[model samples]
Target: MSRLARLGLAVTLLFALAAPVRAQVKDDTPRNYGVGRVATPGQIAGWDIDVRPDGRGAPPGRGSVKDGEKVYLDKCAACHGEFGESAGRWPQLAQGKGTLASHDPVKTVGSYFPYLSSVFDYIRRSMPFGDAESLSNDELYAVTAYVLNLNDIVDDKFVLSKETWSRVKMPNQGGFFDDDREKTEKAFWNSNPCMKDCREPVKITGHAQAVDVTPDEKTQKRGVE
Candidate 1:
């Protein structure tokens, strides 16, 4: 071999041998990345407030529809109508049966929400608009019951609690489905991963535009304010 070829081969061999030495070096100096202190149990509990779809993690409380109605009117009626039919630009909380596929879908608790625990979780954490997390546990239960009553799912006398939560099911309860991507789509992905050949560059196609669909800037700023 020529002198240039020999020098190139020697450098490549040195790199191939040095890679293992670098890999074997132990990084035992203890990286002190000052990434905040360890959180306390109480601090963790305050932020860890996620409720399950199966009625788990719900706080204990009871509230009657009668009380719920009062609470709804006093606190929720201003935005949500007297019967949960959103006022003005506010979102409608009830009604809208069988309108999911239509051009104008009116998603409400009665028509869209899948889980009842979601209602409890949402209201308890982010309800009464500006004054979120201000309502007591019992008051939140009442609010939930009242909303259910508006949808005619529960009677005016129904008293909702964490235990009886599972009993309250939305109309479109089974409308959803579990994703079967692993079984149905995994084969498509694993079947053909290699691309050995090239194709001609495709021409640009007509693009679609979404006009008059977005909310105005003013309305966006005052969201549920």
Candidate 2:
């Protein structure tokens, strides 16, 4: 056999021999590191606080726009103005109905967000600037409803809960669609990449010396390219 063929056969034999050893070692090693216990249902519940668009995982709670306004004024008004107009550099949460297509579009809770669940999830996960996950379930629901009321999306009497969450439709709900780039942009894709001589041979059109960008050869250090 050729020297390269002999080397290849040796490598294959070595790998074949090591395969059983590797499998044995893997089987002998403990899969569990013995560091932490499996999470309790209560612990899992705490971490699984995400609210979905379809109202799945929503906590059983209710909050009225009026109650939300009170909570908003006390907890949220310092940053998001008295009526969700936004204070200083903070985000504006209301009054940008027809401004989306304009040059300076004010993307607030109402004008830009495609889902109410997203708003609820954001507030539930992180809100009041610093004290994240501090609000009660009712407060979270109320504050969310209040934001909707600020945008005129909900009436002052509207009470938001798991029951009514599905009834509320966001203004930009129809703006979002599933990603179809694979289907739409597949025609322009180049799967096979060229590595060698893929284009016309590159010719030296000019040199750095022609543009006077190169240092003087006399000043260049010896043995340096």
Candidate 3:
């Protein structure tokens, strides 16, 4: 089996073995460390981070859009712009409100995401590039609120907390539809595919006048291309 499959099997076996004693314990979820020992509470806390779409697993805390600006400038502005327009190759986090159907769509936290939990969860675990998981709960809340304010999803006075987190609606919340292709597209599978009569013969209609992706001949020799 693959590495992931093996690890999953190990976790399942461990959970089954330790479920009886730990079933009544309710502070946090149980975990297995793969070394024939149960993971400690501290270790479980580090990895037990995952916020759902309906805000079922959010932790208790609060932050405001006003307070979030400072956190954004200090920690996030170096990579993502002050207003969430990202630098050189970094990901943009704000704006892109109505460009989802445009030719050059800019997907940002405001325009593309469907869940507020995702915004909070991402920064909580994987933000600030080099310094990941360094922000405190309030700091993460503040930065998240600031990014939302940049996109106009929330006002400056709006406070983000576990209680009000799910109330903030994203523009694309209902943009995606549930997958029903298996039932609706049964005709496609019932009939045989027309390999010979699929479409007209392919033809090249355009060519690039000046473009080169291949490295220079000299650069190739040095293996630095």
Candidate 4:
């Protein structure tokens, strides 16, 4: 081919490749969809509320179990029952004092939760369903005290405040342990194996049968099976 024609073909290919590069550079520009505004301190203070286990974020207030009982009856009894037994498919907040590892374990505030702060945090963040964060600090304290009283963990006259919050200990506090995978790894690696014929043959000894399989008189009268 001629030298000028070859040079023109090379220029055409270079422009075609550069067109995509230019289009990509244009598409990669920073986009701002009105979601990049900085938050003020007041805005942060309104939403940044979280309590720690060591009673770090407890608000300043107090409430006795007696006062909490009144609050529970007025505000919480409709869903949580008059005694925290749960209305329907809600949650039972009380009872289950010492039944953690049973076949039918009844896990409640008194039996399962390890920290009291979690209870307070949960109430503060979400409670009474539709009305969130409506309770005052003292009211939250009173409700927590009432729940503890209902769980049989504290006396009816016991007061719960920032000062006395950490004194209450749950029944299953010692049930949790830190993860020790290193020790577990050594134990698993050093164990002996029984790969050959380790399992024994099993036999079916008993079978389950329905006891109340009798049909009702109405079905018999209707000639329905």
Kindly give the stretch of ten consecutive residues in candidate 4 with the minimal lDDT sum. Answer: 20-29
What's the C-alpha lDDT at position 180 in model 3? 89
Residue lDDT tens for model 3, 1-225: 999999999999999998776455455666664677778999987788888888776777888888889988998898898888999889998888788899989988899998888788888879877899888888888888889899999888999888887679988888889998998987778566776867888897866645556566877556466
* Model 2 CA deviation exceeding 4 Å by range: 1-36, 179-225
Residues 162-203, candidate 4: write the lDDT tens digits. 889778876677778999888877766755777787788878
TM-score of each: 0.65, 0.66, 0.70, 0.65
**Which candidate has the top score in lDDT?**
2
Model 1 lDDT, full chain set: 0.86
lDDT of 1 by residue, 167-225 (tens): 88778788788998888777677655758645677775744444456666877555484
User: What clash count goes with each model?
Assistant: 0, 0, 0, 0
lDDT over C-alpha atoms for residue 108 of model 2: 90
Ranking 1 against 4 by lDDT, winner:
1
Q: Model 2 Cα displacement at 188 (Å)? A: 7.8
After TM-score superposition, the amount by which residue 195's alpha carbon in candidate 3 deviates from its true location, in angstroms, is: 5.8
The candidate maximizing TM-score is 3
Question: What overall lDDT goes with each candidate model?
Answer: 0.86, 0.90, 0.84, 0.84
Mark the regions of model 3 whose C-alpha exceeds 4 Å error after superposition: 1-35, 40-42, 180-202, 207-225
